[model samples]
Target: MKAQPIHTIRLILIPFTLEITKTLMAGDTSILQQLGLQLTPYWPDQEAIDTFPKIIHNLEKVPEPNGFESYMVVHRHSMTVIGDAGFKGLPNTEGEVDLGYAIITQAQKNGYGLEVAQGLVNWAFQQTNVKAVTARCLLANVASARVLERLGMQQVSSDAELIRWKLPKPVTQATIK
Candidate 1:
């Protein structure tokens, strides 16, 4: 069966040179504090790693990371780096990939995450091989889960603290006839 296009957001291809750009320019880290994500285990060495370097390093190497194709979420209006959304893992044996994202505190509840999530999924589908997209969120993270559902993903199951969601194989273009 042929794959289909199944998402509803516009996507742009940004080079790693942009997101991973490193310079002496002062950067804002307030988004971290605002989102309450600054201390997450994801960034375990908060002190030694340093904020700027961490982001640069993450951007620089994320595409080839063990399980992610990270991209920086930037505001088209203000042009500030807002948050991040990306595919979290390679296509599994079943041909599905995991999706994940986060928004700086101030950026939350404003529809950015939703747009980026949709856009990312749209872009993934354009890769022309992905059968589906899966997202796992903390059970208590209603907001995150809502992003997936609002994009038409359905709750598949849960394990412990994680809520798993799925976007079924897209309706193929051939099927549209």
Candidate 2:
């Protein structure tokens, strides 16, 4: 299956290829430059860099267009990779898919997180059997919570440390016969 890049007003969510993941895991910069992404300061937060190897492993099991793979959030104007985002995997039997994202320190506060999440959530809903998208953020992450809220996700659960949000598939009106 072909992996199609999801586009937003200012970002392009390109699925991470296995080769790219491996290269990243190995601390290689050539691939980034090869992809025309900015080098040097190009870096996601520690969390994303640490979790990517595991993401690659999981993607190996399910493969693209079916598995839960991460996407490189490319800034359209700068042509630089500003972050990463995507679902945890295919939707569960209940048709719920978990989503996550992180913007680089330099790229934060530019509304990239919201744009990326909105694009991914919309893409997920367009897929077969996807009924809802879910996300959670640390209680300290007010920005992330705001992004979810702006995306129209409802708070379903919360604790001292985290808040969970969900967005159900939008209802479409059918024409009368």
Candidate 3:
């Protein structure tokens, strides 16, 4: 079965089904029409294309999408695929799921990156197995850093080239009882 989409105010995040990924890898535009989404000129760019093998490998493990892989970021108003975002894989033993996202050049600076990242983090936190959501951005990527900060992720560590951020699940009254 296909995973249900995660809807935001201005975007709908559709998980990449095996068929969808395979079609996308093959450079077919029919998947867009089949999903009722319009295609942007820059979507499924080189990076997205390069990641297909891994996405496909991960999706193939389950009988269906289980909400732990890539999702195409669709603009709600235009119904166009602007980019992709999703968890790297299932939560680790430490219960952390890595997050990654990118908005196409045409869609950047419109706050879609933050909206989709926030949506993905929110969804991951709701999962019982996820204790925290983690992400890494290049040192020079100020935009991504700002988005992570806005999402309430604290800087946990950094190296010469990359900075890591993590957001832990908030404690609730129910959890303390």
Write down the lDDT of every candidate, Cα atoms only. Answer: 0.59, 0.84, 0.90
All candidates: TM-score: 0.65, 0.92, 0.95
How many backbone collisions does model 1 have?
2
lDDT of 1 at 61: 48
Q: What's model 2's lDDT at 36?
A: 82
In candidate 3, which residue pairs get closer than 3 Å at backbone N, Cα or C atoms, i.e. clash? Answer: none
| lDDT for each residue of candidate 2 in 1-177, tens digit (9 for 90 to 100) | 556889999998888878888888787868988988776465755766897886787678764545356898999888888888998877889899999999988888989999999899878877768889999999999999999999999999999999999999887763112
Q: Highest TM-score: which candidate?
A: 3
Stretches > 4 Å off in candidate 3: none
What lDDT is reached at residue 95 by model 2? 94
List candidate 1 segments past 4 Å from native: 1-68, 175-177
Clashes of each: 2, 0, 0
Candidate 1 vs candidate 2, lDDT winner: 2
Prediction 1 global C-alpha lDDT: 0.59
* Model 2 lDDT, full chain set: 0.84
Q: In angstroms, give how far residue 76 of model 3 lies from its true place.
A: 0.4
In the range 3-116, model 3's lDDT, one tens digit per residue, is 679999999999999899999999997889888988677888887898889899989888889898999999999998888899888899999999999888878999999999
Q: Following a full C-alpha superposition, what root-mean-square deviation does model 1 have from the true structure?
A: 8.4
